[model samples]
Target chain A: MNTLMRWIGIAVVIFIAAPLVIVVPMSFSTAASLQFPPPGYSWGYYQQFFSDPSWLRPAWNSIYIATMNTLLTMALVVPATFALVRHKFWGKSFANLMMMMPMAVPHIVMAVGYYSYFGELKLVHSKLGVILAHSCLSVPITFLVLSANLKGFDLTLERAARSLGATPGQVFRHITLPILKPGLAISALFAFIQSFDETVVAIFISGRDAETLPRKMFDSIREEADPVIAVISTLLFAVVFAGLIAPSLIKGLRRMAGGTPSK
Target chain B: MSAYLRLAGVNKTFGNFTALGHIDLEVEKGEFVTFLGPSGSGKTTTLMVIAGFEKATRGEITVADQSLAHLAPQERNIGIVFQNYALFPHKTAAENVYFPLQMRKVGKKEGMKKAAEMLDLVGLKGFAHRLPKELSGGQQQRVALARALVFEPDLLLLDEPLGALDKNLREQMQIEIKRIQKRLGVTTIFVTHDQTEAMSMSDRIVVFSNGAIEQAAAPLDIYHRPATRFVADFIGESNLLEATITDAATGKAHSPVLGEVTCGAEGLPPLTDGQAVSLLIRPEHLKLSREPKEGRQNAQMVIETIVNYGDNAVVIGHAGDQQIRVRVPGADVVILKEGDSCHFSWTADAVFVLDK
Candidate 1:
């Protein structure tokens, strides 16, 4: 049974990793078009991706929009999550359901809705429009992460701080915010990545001035299958891999510095 | 002497449910008072009200003659060690203790030095750098105590601080806390449901029941003279007998099982003849023998059970439908057995009378 389970796990890993594995090799290929086994290997595509204005513009736009989306999303979701999780009021369950509504709807459906809705607001084709749209899309995941953290938080610590002579604002600064830093960081990271990789809504709303990287990549793949797309994919994959592993590396470093025996 | 802390008619009601009912108490400087009661008996609620976490619906609380009505919890200048200790998991012991000093604008070096000294007072001399999770329960409790007392606030409130410790460790912490409170001379209020803890660690105990104070008195006084039947039943083992006052002046009361008995008249309210009352006989005050004893109230009972505690044993028996308990030394249990009829007697001074 154990051997069978191990084989199943290996099969699952290969299934999930096969596409990613292909993207890295394709990024290093000299092919002019999509191919499984590249005709040859070269750094030509990487150079093209770096020097091209069309690609760089969207990459910069994505970074700018994602950063703004993260800030705005955190500003709105942090307090909303606190209110939803830490308080009892009428229509609370309904409010929680409403916060999660954007995530539940299909992205294509939201794209259609935003195409007309943002058009009416004259926010289409702008960085502000993409940021506003991405902030909406990122709220659910941010709220989920933050609410879970807030739920596990021992409120007695706040009370203890208050009893120890900290005002409410000071308690938040000294105790609540510091203790929740990791959760807040992870939640903000999720919001940034959510907006950076969101393609459907960006394709519908971000026309030329605020074309996000994902929308550019989507159009490139559909039109010409640009080899630069592979380079971008590989770089994105490397970033995700680092993000996944950084937490454990940090924990290990902290343990070594503390020098205390673990339980 | 002027009271250091005063809670005057403080009442708290959550919607329709009353959590504390007209709680009025005063504590002198450097006094350690324990609120003793069962769960949901308003002991913890009273502590919360004093800590300013729960606002009293109707009354005033004052410290050093200043009313605390408009003050927030932080403005009250109080320190509290919660039941679970509530130490910040991210902060080291020294940092946890240094927090209050830091808030008061103390410099990093001086605040941390004061924190280390407070840790030393709690007997955790070198544990300053360890995080709360790295410490054991007792160690964590010590860190919490050091943190609460380091600021030297006007009052210290401990809400069942030793509830998590083992028996031996709890006893040790009880003494440790008492010594620290005395050394600091901080007006302290400790809350616990453990009667023995209240007896051993408190200058006075306030017994709570159903959102009201049952009685507040010294430990021995509460044991010897409980103000109500609930107090009598809660504080210690007592065989309460329903009786009627035969003569108030002579302190005579008549019970079904033990006919006309003499009781202590000290502190008893004025009683009329034929008035219904409760006669309290503490188990330790009763003597057991095979025959009736001379110069004391005597009654015969059949032993129903014997609970031996090595040093002493509680022999439970019944007399004509009335249950009676007698506490005998362990050596004396050799001659007694279950189902055997025995005579139990108590002196007149041991019998306490309570009016219904």
Candidate 2:
């Protein structure tokens, strides 16, 4: 049974990796149109991706908007998650359901809603509209991650600190915040990635002035099938690969350092 | 005279459940008091009230004539070592100890120096650099003690800090905690459900049951003369007998198991004739013999079971419908076995009468 399970796991990995393998080599292809097994290969698409202002503007817009979305999402979610996880009050279940409601609705449905909503508010093509819309989408995952961490935290540490002459603010600064740093970091990263990779809603509302990278890529794929999309996909894959492997590499190094005999 | 710490008419209720009921206590400076009780007995609730974490529903608490009703826990200047030893996991032992001093705005050099000294006082001289996870259970307990005591707060509260250790380590930490508490002359309240720990470490034991104080007296007084039937059964091994008083002046009581009995009258209240009462006798106070001894109260019982420990054995038997227990030296077990008819005797002073 174990051998069979191991073979199944290997097959699943191959199934997920097959599409990504195609994208990496296709990014270097010199072909102009959408062709899988390209006739030639070069770094021409990479040069075009880096130099063209049309692509560069959307890339910058996505970075700026994602960063703002992360900040706003964390600011709103942290205290709300603490309250929802730690205290009991009336209507708490309803409030929790409301926070997760955006995630329940399909993004295509939200795209239509935001199109009408932002057009009425005259925020249809602005950066602020994209940020506000993305923050709503980011709240559920951020709250879920943060509330799980807050629940696992041992509350006796705060009590001990308070008894040791730490005021409420000092307790939060010294004990609660430091202990929750890693969870906060991961939750903020999730919010940033959620906004940066969002395409459907960005396509409906980001119109022309605040065009996000995903929205621009979607349009480019439909109109001309720009090879630069493959280049961008490869770059994003490399970045995620580095992010995934860095923590374990650092942990292995620490283990080796800790195992050495100390004077 | 005003006491150092006073809790007057302190009552706490959570919704419909009463957690504490009109608790009034006064503690002299430098005295070690143990709140001994089973779970849900308001001992910890009282501690939280004193520590300013739980607000009393009605009354007030004062330490040194200063009302604590409006003060937050951080302003109470009380140190507490929790049952789980809530040491900061991210900080070293020295840093954990220095936290209170840092909060008080002490300079880093002086605070760290004092922290090291406190660590040394708790016998953790070379262990100042290790985190709490790296330390053993007993070592973590010592670091917690050091951190709680480093600032020399006005009061110290320990809530079953030794519950996590094994037998030998628990005993060792008990002595160590008592030594540190005495050396600092800090007014301390230790809460524990273990009666043996209370008996061995406390200057006075306050027994709690059902959110009320059952008895508050010195350790030996609480042991030899429990005020209530709950105290008698909760503190130690006891054989409680239902009896009726025959004479108030002569302290005479009649029980079905032992026909006529004389009880100690030093602290017992006045009793009326034909009043129902409970007679308590400690297990070790009863003497077991093959025959009735001369000049002592004796009763005949059929031995049902004998549990052997290394140094002593408990002999459980029945006299009529009442169960009796007698402690005997291990050497006497060779000549006795289960199912033997034995005579158990005690002096008048050993029997305490409680007018339930």
Q: Pick the candidate with the highest TM-score.
A: 2
For model 1 chain B, the run of ten residues with the poorest summed lDDT? B260-269
- Give the lDDT of residue B119 in candidate 2: 97
Model 1 DockQ reads: 0.65
What are the TM-scores, per candidate, against the unseen true structure? 0.93, 0.94
Give a tens-digit lDDT track for model 2, residues A1-263.
Answer: 99999999999999999988899989999899757987799999999999999999999999999999999999999989988999999999999998899899999999899989989999899999999999999999999999989999999999999999999899999999999999999999999999999999999999889999999999999999998999989998998899889988998887788942232
| Candidate 1 ranges beyond 4 A from true positions | A1-15, A29-44, A254-263, B265-267, B334-336
Q: Cα deviation in Å at residue B285, candidate 1? A: 2.0
In candidate 2, residue B204 scores what lDDT? 93
Model 1, B273-299: lDDT tens digits are 999999889999999988899998799
> What is residue A198's positional error in candidate 2, in angstroms?
1.1
B-chain TM-scores per prediction: 0.98, 0.98
